[model samples]
Target chain A: MQGMIWLLGFLIGASPDSVAQQIMWRVYNRPSFQDMHAQITMTLIDPNGTQRVRKMETWSKKDPKTGETKMLIKFMEPADLRGTAFLIYQHKDREDDMWFYLPALRKTKRLAASGKSGAFMGSDFSNYDIGGGEYEDWNYRLLREEDLDGIPCWVIEALPKSPDVEKKSGYSKEIRWVNKENDLVVRTDHYDRSEMLYKRTVVKDAVQIQGIWFERVIEATDLDSGHRTVMEFTDIRVNQGLPDDLFSIRALGR
Target chain B: MAISWLMVLLAYTHLGGYLRFESFVRVDSGYQIHKLATTLQLRTTLDQPGISGFSALNLIMDRRAPDPVIFRPIELYLTFHRGPVDLTLGKKILTWGAGVFVSPSDFVNPWDFSVLYSDLEEFREGIEVADFAYYRGNAFVELAFLPMFRPNTYPLPSLQIPVPAGPDTFVVFMDGTHPVLPEPTLKKGEGFLRVGGTWGPMDFRLLAFRGFDRDPDLQVRYVWLPGSNPQEHPPDTIHLRPEYRPVWMGAGTLTWIVGPWELHADVAYVRTEDTDGTLPTVKNPYVYGAFGFFRSFWNDQWSLGLDLLVKRIFAFGQTPEDPMGVNALLEEQARMLNFQYEETQPSLAFHLQGSDTRDLWRWSASGIYDLRAREGFLLATLSYAWADGVSLQVGGLFSGRKGRSPFSQMGRHLGQVGFLEARWSF
Candidate 1:
């Protein structure tokens, strides 16, 4: 397990800044494979640059006897959000179980996981940036080692350790970077709740497929409404077995 | 030409559609023009592998219709599936409860009050059932049936009665009532049975219907109007015929999620055939209900809903004192069929809606009222999506009444309307 967490942090003498805070909890507990299927494409833009675009199709998984993870998404292209759909489940200790189908009200509803910091289809990526937040609800630290754009990074920072995780993560600190050769997360900034900064993400083309790694483009932006989002990913696939009735809820209104 | 073979199978399937164009202008004084429309809708999908099919079509034209090209066929169903059952068939558009603008366990399809307040899924309409569903992990079990019987399209096709000639004189007819359906016999079809699930943060359903009564029940007919010198001003004409009966419901719905609010409820009970209440053209057993909450703000780009429906009426009799009032003038012309003339009616609604934060401007407002029939309704809209399936909108509709409510006799007979729309989708 990453050499038993670096031999229990080198037999507890642990320092060097807590081994860069155990590499920010091993880059936020990285490890994958249990099912996925993608095909995205987002866009958005605005600040008078006018853009829009959408398209989706997702499917996640991870159950293996309820370790919970589900997912599902749908919306293929913006014909006013065609066929809608969205589901989630996520859970490890609570709060996450959403649904919303709406193919022109063929109903489905059930949302409100406290709007996990909202945005999401109006895009600057929220819903806690598509369900990724939770490593003891944030505390991380590291912040130093540089090089991004020439690879070799590690920045970290995090923070939100409650206030209901800073009010469900409308964030009040974040500043990632990671990827010192593979822990992914290429960039982020966010902050807002008066801590300023307010959104920025970046990640870009990183491939690898079957042996994991992913991240094919992302973008975000919104430094105070100059609005932008990008996303991308495509046909991704991972661990094949899929079908738990494709995240059930009657596969979210077909 | 089945719409030219569905426009030649929409060029090999999977198509979708939309095209609107509206324009109304009534200001009640001066602006005039009232309506001008254009609609077109299409839809297609076919899938295969245990069969699947779907279709939709509409097409309108309206320059105040007297025949301005209409055509409908809103759906055409066909599912088949297998391992866990599924079996649709023909015209569909089912939508059961979770009330949001009313859904007392939605009754099979009928409510195109000629687009009353438009786009509530185009006021529903698509019926010819035979559903059947099954599934079991997240629970489900449906069972439709229906088979003919659709009625509920009104924008008043005639009715202007007012006869009484003499001593203050009057005589104006127009009637055209017509509506006495039911006879395609599969034992006069209509059916329902649902049962739903999802149980952690709740979500439920449970219905049961035995249908027939998408409004209609009023029967009076009188005529005499022979004058010219043979009589001496003898006028009278009042014809109202509608009649369709058979009811029985029992609905239910629940939705819950309590953390940022999202509670819902919907209930029903109906029974009809005057169950105890003197039948002055039947309508008595009742119980309906709705209760709601929904929220989302700022980050969700604002949203809010609030509801309250309620309807009670059970054995509320008394109405045999009309000496010469002629049955209170056929119960005031059947109160324009929104029925439930009292015995606790309640109502209250709200909507809100918002956008803009690059969602490209949008807005909304809604209201309802009707508490003890003091009556109310208001709507407002503003939109602009401008692309990705185009858009542009402007709207208004208002009503407020105390004029002895039946929604103030349908707001003194359908009196407000305002619009400007444009859309496109593909």
Candidate 2:
């Protein structure tokens, strides 16, 4: 009995901070859904308040057995950018795979690992942010708990555990405000390499779809550039049981 | 007349169009040449449950040309799609090959070589055809029948060939004579077939065509003697005619993705009617192939592409014991813009493109180096999007050569042209 206690103690000590992990796990692990499909509109706003809107259709599926996620996005607006597609396969323990199809060239090009740090479709979000970085790559600390905008939340600070991970990410550290009610990320502040706040993201219009909480509207603001992007999701369907072939490279061209 | 026709069509169909105007100036060697042109495009589309039709008309006017205005029906096609079968008919531009820079298998539409310095997509000229396509899963088969013959258009004499004064030669000029063109009839139609599909992470296609060579061959009828005295002949005339011959071609293309890179290859084998090379006027059989690689870096902000092409001829003109005769025949063939078969020709080309995250600014550079001809051309452009649909572009064109090659000849005439353009779209 004494040995069991010591082993348990050691294992608990080696793992991430329990308070922060609990909050993050709750936020990341939502209700089970096989697949999702949605029509999204992204509006980019400049410093002068001028806006440019882009429309796209997205489909994503998660493999239950492997715990891998596959996403496919196809552009539907902006005459010059029509018929462009992007496909991504995110693995649990390794690097992700990405492919882009350009209609003008009638060709498909693969993107390298370093591409994750780049912007996503001229938006304020980076590719890494869109793909969701590996949660274990960072060390999490529970900073404090407070009420934000009349909702109780836990503020958490996450720092990259290694220099390599920091280099591959556009952010040196991130602070997230997690809503305790539904375990949703209500707000986040991303710090650059120099530890300066570079961007801020806010989530709104939270609703339950198929017993899973989803943010219907998201806005990201670039602090230095005074530019922002707003994404609104509509015609959303969950647990659609999409076919595996929909995420393959062949579907990119189709 | 075209405006009235467009108005009548718009009453029954959806209407859209754009007007574009551009100016080009060449400043080189104490000479300045300016060309200004305006183009108007009218487009119409009609959609129903299972049928659709689209048409585009182009009207162009040039300030410096003899015929200032011209009208062309760029695309006029109707498509019927039901279940797995799709059929289209009328005049249309069909692109059949997978090559990015050089398409060895795209034989359906003849191109306008006069605008070779412009965007590659602008080089195509639509042709009348009946096309049918069937799809099953990821595989598709397409068949087309071209009912009319359209020949490729080349640049004018002043741009293609330049005459230089020599110590012994007085004056040499090619006579401007209209060549005989093939009669437009159903019996002289062409046929094309392509079967393509994506299977197991690779895309492949097989194509076959039976058509006339768009580029014509040169036939020298006779050389007129000036004043019946070789020494006193101040000017000599070379009577030449352009001839179009039938050809059979088979081609294949494959694109494979390996890790973070995509590799592509295209090859075509052309067999002309002149098999024995007995006729000095016709071109011999040849094979053309190109291999390319493409990759994107820095989050797709930058991309690099490279392609290598080779053209090999199966047979040269009749072999002669005397080397001078071979040289004379080769020179005659060269004047017709035919590939020199005595030496295998290889060329390399590369394109580098980049843009910022917001896509407000873009820059690209491309170059082609001909190994056998020892000549090359480089083109670079930088563009800025001032607004949503307004853009400004600045670019330069440079050519280099070691000897009296075709590109060298072009450089002498169109040396170091610089251009700036502004475009607006709605």
Q: Write the per-residue lDDT of candidate 2 for residues B250-330, one digit (tens) a residue.
A: 999887766556678889998887576655656777888889887778777998878887877776755333322333443
Which ten residues in a row are the worst by lDDT in model 2 chain A?
A: A1-10
Q: In model 1, what are the clashing residue pairs, if there are any?
A: A55-A77
Q: What's the true lDDT of residue B43 in model 1? A: 80
Model 1, span B202-299: residue lDDT tens: 88888888978787767655555554332443336555666678888888889888878888998889787778866666677788888988888777
Provide the clashing-pair count of each candidate structure. 1, 0
Model 1 agreement with the true structure over A1-254: per-residue lDDT tens digits: 43455458668887545765677766665677688888899998878887889889888888777667888898877786787888888888767878878877677788877767877777888878878887778777665668887987768788887788877888888888877777788888989878999788898787887676878888989888778889998888888897676577876876
List, residue by residue over A38-90, the lDDT tens digit for candidate 2.
Answer: 99998899999988778899999999999789899998655446568998878
Give the C-alpha miss distance for residue A11 in model 1, angstroms: 14
Q: Please give each candidate's TM-score.
A: 0.34, 0.79
Give the Å shift of residue B304 in candidate 1: 2.0
